[model samples]
Target: MKLKSVFINTTNCITPLGLDVETNIRNISKGISGIRLHKNLVYAEQPFYASIIENSLIEEAFSSVSSSEEYTRLEKMMILALMPVIKKMNPVFDEKTILIVSTTKGNITQLSTISETSAQSADLSLMAQKIASFFGFITEPVIVSNACVSGILSLAVAKRLIQSEACNQAFVVAGDEFSKFVLSGFNCFQAVSNEPCQPYSVNRKGVTLGEAAAAACVSANGQNALAEIVGDGAINDANHISGPSRTGEGLFRSVERAMKEAEIKSEQIDYINAHGTATSFNDEMEAIAFNRSRLGNVPLNSLKGYYGHTLGASGLLETVIGIESLNSGKLYPSIGFDEMGLSQALNIITQNEEKELNYLLKTASGFGGCNTAVLFKKAK
Candidate 1:
């Protein structure tokens, strides 16, 4: 049986850079860095660089569509990011449509302050249900919380659902908010970068966290679609809990499988939106993986410098910007890169350059040794 093609029809994002896709793309095109220093916010008495949505802004946006007093910050951001696309689709909540929520640390901020109902408020499933119910989704919501891969992996799941006739359309939303829980965990690992992130740079320190919510509508309908999801793969090398494989084993296999499923050779790939977290191990591992897959010559970049590491939202946020890149026929530079930092060479994008991007590859690696690769093509 021939599987139906899944296309990304529309997308939107709410981040420090902007509240919509076009705005975020314009800011990134001008080399604007959203990651900035915030004093005593997530980490008290310690200044850290992060990309965060201001509380006032969130309240202001939420007030337009809702007067509810019970929504949490994460829920508000998710609603704001998804509201425009939802309005555009105005999709009926029926058996044919499904909602999927992807997040790493939903309502983790509840842990920062002691509350009698703290554990209940921090429930990921409850958060997913609230978002789904807010939109009147008839079907029970699905949740994807697999580390950083949650964002992109949700897309792959949506594609499969359509192909399998489980649903005719899907709205996938992925988000994470900056909180003491996340910051403190990273601090414990010494993975929090002091300066703005610089992926694939010799002087790169570590990752800078960020907060964002990104959503996309996926369907079998091809009309006016932004891009087609051609292929996808997920793998876990199980190298380590917190560290990536020394040899890029899992990433290499994931990219290889995705390319094979797309029925495209490495040379056909026009651009790569890599998961360069600016960590020393991650950059080096990705470089080795690209070289292993013979994708070393493809021009690639990491948007972390502009968005910081938005955790669960990074994959979808980066992919949305990538769609813009392909439509504009221009490659955005990896914002904070200065020089080649890995032993294996990658043709990193240094400056904005005009290129006809037909096939784009997006790769992401996370804790628990999970890595995902997804291939997308221009809808034409």
Candidate 2:
């Protein structure tokens, strides 16, 4: 059977930089970064750099949508991100529509509280259900939580569901918030950067965690679409539990499969939105993967500098920015990058430039040796 075509209809994001996509893009164009140094003793004993959304801002914005204070910070952010997308698309919450929620940790902060309500609220499924019910979604909501790849992986899942005739439309939402649990976990791993992250730079230290929520509307209909979903592939190397494959095996395979499904060669890719976590291993692994996939020459940039590592929201949030880049015909610079630090050379975009882009590739690698690549084409 011939598969159905899928397109990204609308997108929105809630971040420390801004609430709307245009606002965030404008800030990014001006070389603004949301990551900053914070001395929250709850998160860490020492001052740390992270892109944390202001609680006041979230409460204020969410108050406009709903006056209820029962929603968690992450849930409020997810609702705010999806609210505009739903308003723009005005999609019918019928059997043909499906909702997908992606997150690395949902309401993990609740786990810190010693209460039955808090424990129940920490359940991923319950969080998904609450968000779905808030929007009156008729179909059962699907949850995607595969480490950092959950964001873009949710989009891939949406595409397959629509293509397979399971649903005609899908609303994909992803988010993760700052919490002591997350901070301690990264601190334990010694992966938290002291300053704003610098991707692909010799001075790079480690990742700067961020909190954000991003949403996208996917449908078979192409009207007013942002970009067409061309192809996607996800692979696992099982090389290590925490560290990525030293040889870039999983990422390389995932990129190869995505390009193959897109029916494009390495040269056809105009730009790449890489999963540059700015860590020693991740940056090196990506450099190796791109070279192995014969895409070493492709202009690539990582958004980690601007937004920090947003965990589950990083992939989808960057994808939203990437679609804007395709539509605007401009490439955003990789903020905080000063010099090449990878073993394999990559053509990293340094300064913002006007480029007529046709095809874009978005990639993400996560724990458990998982890597995902999704290809997008400029919608005609």
Candidate 3:
């Protein structure tokens, strides 16, 4: 039996730079970064750089959607990110439709209080259900929580579910919010950058955390699709609890599998949206993996400088922008890069350029040695 084709039909995102996709793209094209230094002791003991959405902006935008005061800030962001897509497509919430929520920490701030209501709010399943119900989705919602890869991995999951005849249409929403818990955890690992992150740069210190929510519609129907989901692969090296494989073994294998499934060579790839978190090990590991996959020469860029590693939202947010890149034939620069810092060389995009792009590759690696690669072809 032949498998069905899956395509991303519509996309939207809520970020510190903008609320809509076009606005975000405009800011990015102008080299505007959302990362800012914050001295709030609630989030960190010392001043730290991060991309954070303004509370007033979120409240104002969400007021037009719903007047309920019960929704958490993260939920509002998720709803805002998904609202535009749902309005544009006006998809029917039927039995054949599924909702997928991806996140690393859902309302983890609720835990700071340690109350019954807070505990329920922190539950990932409950959060997913609430989002689903808010949209009037009849089917039970699905949760994807695989470290930092949750966003992109959710898309892969949607593809498989549609292909397997389990669901004809899928609504995927991914998000993570800034909280003291997350900041302290990364602080413990000494992975929080003091300034805006510089991926693959000699001066790079570490990652800059951000909060965002992104949504995409995946369906078997190819009508008005942004891009065709051709292939995807995910692998886990289990090298360490926090560190990625030193040899890029899992990432290399993941890319190999994706290319094989797509039946394409690395030379055919027009550009790569890499998971360049600016961490020493992650940047080095990705450089190695791309070179091993013969993708070293492909023009690549990391959106971390612009968005500051939005945790679960990074992959999907980057993927949304990448889809725009394919549609517009424009490449955005890797914002904070100065000089090559990795042992393996990569063709990092430094300035905005227009080119006829056909195939785009998006990759993400995260804790627990998890790595994912998904291939997309420009929709004709």
Score every model by TM-score: 0.98, 0.99, 0.99
lDDT (10s digit) by residue, model 3, range 249-357: 9999988988998899999999999999999999999999999999999999999999998889899999999999999999999999999999989999999999999
Per-residue alpha-carbon lDDT of model 2 for 1-380, expressed as tens digits? 77888999999999999999999999999999999999988887899999999989999999999998778889999999999999988878899899999999989998897899888889999999999999999888999999999999999999999998899999999999988888889889998788899999998999989999999999999987999999899999789989999899999999999888889999999999999999999999999999999999999999999999999999999999999999898899999899899999999999989989999999999999999999999998
* lDDT score, candidate 3: 0.94
TM-score of model 3 relative to the true fold?
Answer: 0.99
2 or 3, greater by lDDT:
3
Candidate 1 residues 272-374, lDDT tens each? 9999999999999999999999999999999999999999999999999998887778899998999889998999999999988999999999999999999
Error of 1 at 66 (Å): 0.6
Ranked by TM-score from best down, the candidates are 3, 2, 1
**Candidate-wise lDDT, in order:** 0.92, 0.93, 0.94
Q: How far is candidate 3 from the true structure (C-alpha RMSD, Å)?
A: 0.8
- Full candidate order by lDDT, most accurate first: 3, 2, 1
* Highest lDDT model number: 3
What TM-score does structure 2 among the candidates reach?
Answer: 0.99
Evaluate residue 303 in candidate 1 and report its C-alpha lDDT on the 0 to 100 scale: 95
lDDT of 3 at 271: 96
Model 2 misplacement above 4 A: none
